[model samples]
Target: MATDTTTTAPARPPGTVSWWRRPWIAPLAIVTAVFLATALPRYVGLDPARSLVPTDRGPAFYPALVTHIFTGSVMLSAAVLQLWPWLRAHHPRVHRWSGRVYVASAIPTSIAALVVAQFPSGGVAQQVANTFLGVLLLTFTLLGYRAVRQRRFADHREWMVRSTALAFSIVTNRFWSTVLIAAYAPGALTDPDIGFGSPEIEGAAVASAWVSWIVNLMFAEWWIHRKPKRRSRVR
Candidate 1:
């Protein structure tokens, strides 16, 4: 009798990271670059106009926003490092310390975002959408940290990926605006600049804010599940 001796590799667990996921990948790297390029110059310096918020925002607004920006920068940088597979595989101690920094900083940063969302220059809809985004950021980050504490690495990765998606929604929002502002800016771009339709731009901006996080999370879910389970046959 002939017996089969070939062994099959175990399947990747469902609802987790994709095989292609990595920090330096084009998609993530480009987004992170855009964010840092646009954000650092505006917020890193100690100027109020840098915030781009309406001047009418109370004195407290600038300080709160600055705090949020600084903390968020820390969280974002740490999260990017945490996503590095080489560091996780070869230097786990560094990964753990960075993960702690990401979670601790992200929580307070999300809270600050919620505070700033109350005075949305894009109007009430943007305010509401951004508030929701902050909530999601806080929730996802905490859950991710908790999962790792419980020794559920798969769940930790999934949640952290989702949280990173939401964190990067600011970049997604800009992408949406770049596409949308074209249609919204016809009048503003014209020489006479009549019928600029400020309301239309506001509506489009609000839509971008909502779609930013929602769409990012949707894509994250797809990426996280892209690694599917293999099925077995019984003889």
Candidate 2:
């Protein structure tokens, strides 16, 4: 008779997330999904009228803007999926496909954003902020891609983390803009005359354009540089 010596993996404790899972990621994915659905409806119709293009922007601008939004929405959707750890762990093909989609969508989106940022509605500061953001996003995304090609997966993850943070910054930009508008334009919610285009709100919006991504990148850096806990040696 032979004695069985098979060992099974221990089950996870109930109602607890694995340490491998980042607590912030799932909630961020959900918020990104919901906000994207609500905010991007105007672009879904591809109506140039909805976009409120400044006349000097010319016909080319609207198309580029539409491309930027359309592709950016795809990038955002893919990004939400890409960052989900379970999917990456269990469904590698899905992860790869989403990554491909993200990379493909990001390039055109960044390029179009670079074009659009030149004609900022808020102010020179906002234009400079957006242009800077567009450049960084494009750079981070490419570096991530290059890292993967070179088989430097750790570096790839870090770079993608940066690119994704910047990509998702638009959501924060909206949140910050609303808060800043409320602060800058008192009674804005109640007063019909204090429209979105009012100078007070415009100033706030300009501030938000800079603040949103800077805040996001700050958080991303924190996540990236956080010290890992050392496991105790069990005798």
Candidate 3:
């Protein structure tokens, strides 16, 4: 009898593409674009609170501005840490601390969204859309936490991914707003004349938020179920 031996090659680590290796790049780019398009002009140079005041609407504008700034800051910080592997495992304590901070910031930001959505300046359409957003955020957040408490790692990961994707509406909303404005009118991007329910802007924000979360959940489901389905098919 003759013995034959062949060594198998090491398997490559799983991921989408080379670009995803630097996950921080994509998120940072998104944050920068969103800030420039929405938040920066309002807070950095101008008095955002006063500017956001809905002269004919009500007092929801200022509160909304405050919430935007606070939430944007938290998101920017958290987005950086979301690239944890890139940090080279230098400080586990810092990562944990930042996670706690992200959770804390998310709670109030989500609540403020719910309150402001009730009295949206754009009127009933915006109110309805934002109300859905607020409820979705709260639901996903609670579900994520519950999964963790029960030690269901996969469930926790899925829920957290969904929650984070919803939170990223800040970025997606701005992206959609820019696209709509450009496609509709040349100077409509920051036009005060174009309010939330205006034909050019109406539904874009809410749609963006909904699409973001839906896509994320779909991706998570695919990841979780793909291998099992493949195995079943093979059998």
Candidate 4:
């Protein structure tokens, strides 16, 4: 009668909850991937005069622009993969390889960004905004790399998350700039002083640059600190 003494434990859920698995993250990643895919290649294909960079930019600008876009395109494309939880969980080797690519790409991208920031197309506010972003991108990325070296996984994750958000700010900044332009477009097109390309657009660009990373980082921090939902226990 002692043969039926053993009991089976219940199966646990398949995986842990993680911010990377948030529903919104994938869609946003897809959209940004698409945008960078279209936009970056166009610039990469174009000569300096026809590219996004100003025609009269310095000698350093061309090389810097190329480096920024090439590395940025690689970084951004790989970035989407980095946030995919399934990849991290099921294919950790791939995740680690992708992280290496990301960190390597960030090195040249951040350096190029800093170089280009010094010769901003917009005014003082734009310069300041871009410089802050460039420095932050470089600093945070290095910190993340250092954390990984130290085996501080949590710190690495946080710093790298911040770095990624800063990089992605380029997308958010452009989106915000477009929104601001659309808000003012009707008036801007009508007014002789503010038509098409003008200081008003530049002003919006400055504001967008500052707000994008700042807001994204703030949101990232909130997301990182958010309490995990407790799964119900079953007997």
Candidate 5:
């Protein structure tokens, strides 16, 4: 008896994707979400520096602050689109245009950050962190573009990853700032009041930026080197 000859189709694997690989989705989503959340607030009548510790720089500070907000908004917005392959392919023109905008925005932002670093209300540690941020911003950006120009995808990806990570330092700085304030200040922490006098708060912010970047670099290295190592092992 040929009972119930009909057979069910095999089940597909869970979490499968065809257009883009699964691993990339998380990073892209994170970068996009961060960009929108951070950039949108700047224009929504929210002051970026409201949470920052006040600097004694006086009126000159407003202009710098305005520049920081504008440039940072542009930078973050551009960064969100950078990692999406669709933008680079289906919309090559937009990609190139946005790339130019990203580079342009980075100049003023990096310069302003470096300038502010010198007089950071958090003192020397904040200054150093900002300096490193500025230098890395300039270095990685140039390297990424240069790699692309030379058709070196590997180098371009490496440098761009580093640059993107540094850009996220803005996010990390705020996150760490909040964490430190919560741990150290408890109920005393408030918006529009950066607890700059506390060395612990300042140090945490500065340290977070460096730590974030270093961790990002290590991850990138592992990603880039892993395949080669595996191939060598197989051979």
Candidate 6:
């Protein structure tokens, strides 16, 4: 009897994809473009500078706010790029450089977040939520950096997931704010244009702040643990 020998390819890892090479990347790229379009203008150059300074937030607010916006934009873009598995797998050098930029941006972004939190425009609840978010962002990003340095990829991924979730608080907060504002505006106790002390605004602010990062992180945790494990087959 003659036996033919053939080598079989190993199975692809579950849920893995060549996201960078797929046509489906268009949707992701479009979304990223839209994000850049909306978020960039809000925090870039003279636009925000003119709007935030001298009159409204005062001179003291400029430094923190400026740092927050600039670093935030960088961090947001970097974090988004890092999520593409193809980039990390194929171009590890680029991934490392981007990771460094992301972590560096995260440091100042988080610090400015805390600074701005100290003078939160919302009520007590908003203040507490903001403070918690700022601290969590800083702590998680630092922990992620440390984990990666120590070659603890699992811990790094977890901490970075947490960090990115917090970073996305701004986006989630805007979404919640829009929803709540529209829903509560009719029954609001005070005019929307008036003051932060308004009960309606305060309630909405607190609700948005808490729901934003909390909900994001909950989903992140779910995603992180959603990977299916291979089981041993028993004969």
Query: Whole-model Cα lDDT per candidate?
Result: 0.79, 0.85, 0.61, 0.80, 0.68, 0.76
Q: Residue by residue across 1-235, what tens digits does model 2's lDDT show?
A: 9988876656534324464557867788788888878767877787766654443566677778888888999999999888877778778899999999999999999999888888777879989999999999999999999999999999999999999999998889878988888888878867878765679978987999999999999999998999978744433
TM-score, per-candidate, Cα-based: 0.79, 0.86, 0.68, 0.86, 0.70, 0.81
Give lDDT tens digits, candidate 4, residues 1-235: 5587666667643334465657876797778878887678657665776576464668888788788888988888778888877678778899999999999999899999888888776777878888888899999999999999999999999998999889898878777877776674646645657642476776666777788889988988887888988766544
Better of 3 and 4 by lDDT: 4
The best candidate in terms of lDDT:
2
RMSD of each: 4.7, 4.1, 5.4, 3.3, 6.9, 4.3
lDDT for each residue of candidate 5 in 1-235, tens digit (9 for 90 to 100): 6688666655434333245553674575686577557555644554546534464576566556667667877887787777666566677788778877887887788777776666666567667767888888888888988998899988887887777777767766566656756775565375446455666566666666566556666676676677642212211
Residue runs of model 2 more than 4 Å from their true location after superposition: 1-22, 52-56, 231-235
**How many clashes does the backbone of model 2 have?**
0
| Evaluation by TM-score, superior candidate among 1 and 6 | 6
- Give per-residue CA lDDT, model 6, range 128-177, as digits (tens): 88889999999999999999999999999999989988897876677888
State the weakest 10-residue window (summed lDDT) of model 5: 226-235
Error of 1 at 10 (Å): 14
Q: Model 3, residue 183: displacement in angstroms?
A: 4.7
lDDT of 3 by residue, 4-61 (tens): 6756555434332356655566666576566656655566554544554342345665
TM-score (C-alpha, index-matched) for candidate 3: 0.68
Off by over 4 Å in 5: 1-20, 23-51, 58-60, 187-194, 228-235
Ranking 2 against 6 by TM-score, winner: 2
Q: What is the lDDT of candidate 6?
A: 0.76
What is the full ranking by lDDT, best candidate first? 2, 4, 1, 6, 5, 3
TM-score ranking from best to worst? Answer: 2, 4, 6, 1, 5, 3
